[model samples]
Target: MDRTTDIIIIKSIDQLPSVDEIKSISRERALKLVFKENINRQREEIGQYLDDTLSGFLVLIHKIDPELNIVKLITDKEIEDHQNFFEQCAKDYRQLGQKLVFMLVDKLDLNLNKDFPLDTFNELKRDERQIGKVAEWKYFVHGFHCGFQNIITGQYIEVPLVFGLEFGDLDPYFFVKFILSSPDYHPLPIPLFEEYADGLRIIEKMVSLGKFEKIHSKIGGHDGTVVTDREKVEIKSNLDLEKIFVNHIKEIEKKSKFNLWKFLGLKK
Candidate 1:
């Protein structure tokens, strides 16, 4: 239960840790990347997969738990699959976002006052807690404006990323809002939409047949101490987790495009 996940940047492969390898994302800071300079254009680049070879020394350490390293309970294949999803969304070298990849679900009320605490919601806006190691579930990636001019993604937590070279240009305002060319708020052309729909249909069947795996990780207590309790939680850290969205929350679907009214719920 004392497992931990950390990012270690090294100038050379010699710095690789002896512990079981989780996964790593490294790219040369000098590598040229073409992305929109603003939010509007970035939207147009959706459904693009990352196939770039990084040149610099960088790493991304996700939430994992082993008895010793605090690795997740999922298998290695699942871990690699999750990392692929991250790399695809985190296509740009810049890291400056907060988001959630939530599962889709059937009708069920949020069970909260629809007045929807404007003030609370506003406060929630400043929150920075990320749901960790939550792939393997049927979900969509909820991206925020990540990759900032300042502040490295995992700097505060001291992600061990070594840079033997200088940094390079990155997508200025990259947004992680692509769905395999699926029409977002703006609908795609019929041909493109059809392609996306067909791909999604296959994925739906695969998931229904349990093609994907599920992972589990332990949540820490308020004081940063690991805890086993899974309910009635409150964390007063910078995360500002005053009230969780709803314990074991799921998005219950109802609208054409995914929205709050339609969101996910745990399958009974």
Candidate 2:
């Protein structure tokens, strides 16, 4: 009944909070936030998987280059076909760019007074007041864009993800959009099916932590009274995680002949 979700806006990489900061709402609200965060975390893993998959494919294609003597007699049509296929795959990634991973957890053991009222949860809708709060929360929570600059197959594909939540008093449902930039932006909705079931598993861990081991805190309410014994929502305040992508790019350079600057033709 009370506003339990903490509103913390993370502006810099240095300010990232630990997983322990999650202490806000209880029951469904807390669970929802956990689900969202799990999805956010998985986006990075999915991006890396895609990068590795694409890179491995490119290595095979590179073998056909004229610089390699093994393919001295390859046909032009064959080369074109490979190029076309790679381009098409990139296009497909662009289309799938906006997809969001949604997953439901089995919480028969939660023992909460009110369950989410669904056996398998795909989406949840709240009223305007709640939706506005959630939108503002997600806007600040999912505002940043971070991922490796994908240059495999001679294509520039960056997974710059953006998240948005919206609801209108007159509308029948709440809307969430996960936007990904494949050099071209695509906006997609969170679906009922799990894009990755691992997200659900992560939330299960969070839920167990939240239910039994939460670090309780106090906050001042509008009446200037301290609200005690409140569950704190995890505050993730740092943008430094984005540096993982930079590190990944460096690793890619170390392992392969992919000279980024040379690829850009700025350096020999």
Candidate 3:
């Protein structure tokens, strides 16, 4: 499945291997190790609140493009635009007599040219009679493999969004997206791809600065207990996740004034 959440590493900088040293290792092997270590660490430390996909694709992005400063990409104008979008979503949902939230999650951008087996699969294509057999063979080999491209923007842009309707259960595993082509929706006020990228930088800053605990604490006081279809699941939404998220952003704005570069010490 296309994951709708970014893998935010909550561990301290000292706990992770140096980027220079990490780059020396095979990318696949390095990612595997990061998954192993991060999963174990998160389970042992703060598994109660912060659930994350344990991978280092973001690290690879940094290594691949050394000057790819995601932090530098976030701007005040962008944040305002993002917050406005969130408010709009909230307003629309309320009019529909439902609650909605958008969450920024870690997304894996795979180079289909390299990572996907398109050529290999094409080579395995068969005649009509053997279609079932070939499909079975492909399934046996590739399983659920698919390309990682955004259907809307047609870009390699991969980002995850978390959505759990007000009355529904929220799991780390669930997400929902509304397509513009769908009859139920209107055109978005802002460009989604640009907004997502900016929001990612903000989330990146929050996670990197070791504010994971603080952020969760801020929202923890509110009740998270809710009954789902099967049983009760505690999703850390302070009644309304959209409101909590907006409040958190407001707090962040007050704290850093949205100048993440200065707050992160990337600026002099």
In model 2, where do residues sit more than 4 Å from their true spots? 1-235, 263-268
Candidate 2 C-alpha RMSD relative to the actual structure: 31.1
| lDDT tens digits, residue span 1-268, model 3 | 1113223342443544444543454312323222333344443333222212222223222322211111122344444545444333323322221211111011112122211122223332333321221111211112111112334442221111121222221111111122222233345443332233434443343334332111121132422111111222223443555565477679877887467687788975
Output the lDDT of residue 57, model 1: 20
Measured with C-alpha atoms, the lDDT of residue 161 in candidate 1 is 10
On TM-score, the stronger of 2 and 3 is 3
Candidate 3 has its poorest 10 consecutive residues by lDDT at 99-108
Error of 3 at 219 (Å): 13
Q: Write the per-residue lDDT of candidate 1 for residues 69-160, one digit (tens) a residue.
A: 11222223332454433233222222211112011101111132212222222332344422222222222112211111212222111110
Best model per lDDT: 3
Better of 2 and 3 by lDDT: 3
Error of 1 at 248 (Å): 18
Query: Candidate 3 clashing pairs?
Result: 4-160, 4-161, 5-105, 5-106, 5-160, 6-105, 6-106, 7-106
Full-model lDDT for every candidate: 0.23, 0.24, 0.29
- Give the runs in model 3 whose Cα sits over 4 Å from its true position: 1-74, 93-188, 194-197, 200-268
Q: Which stretches of candidate 1 lie over 4 Å from their true place?
A: 1-177, 180-192, 208-268
Number of the candidate with higher TM-score, 1 or 3: 3
Cα error, candidate 3, residue 211 (Å): 20
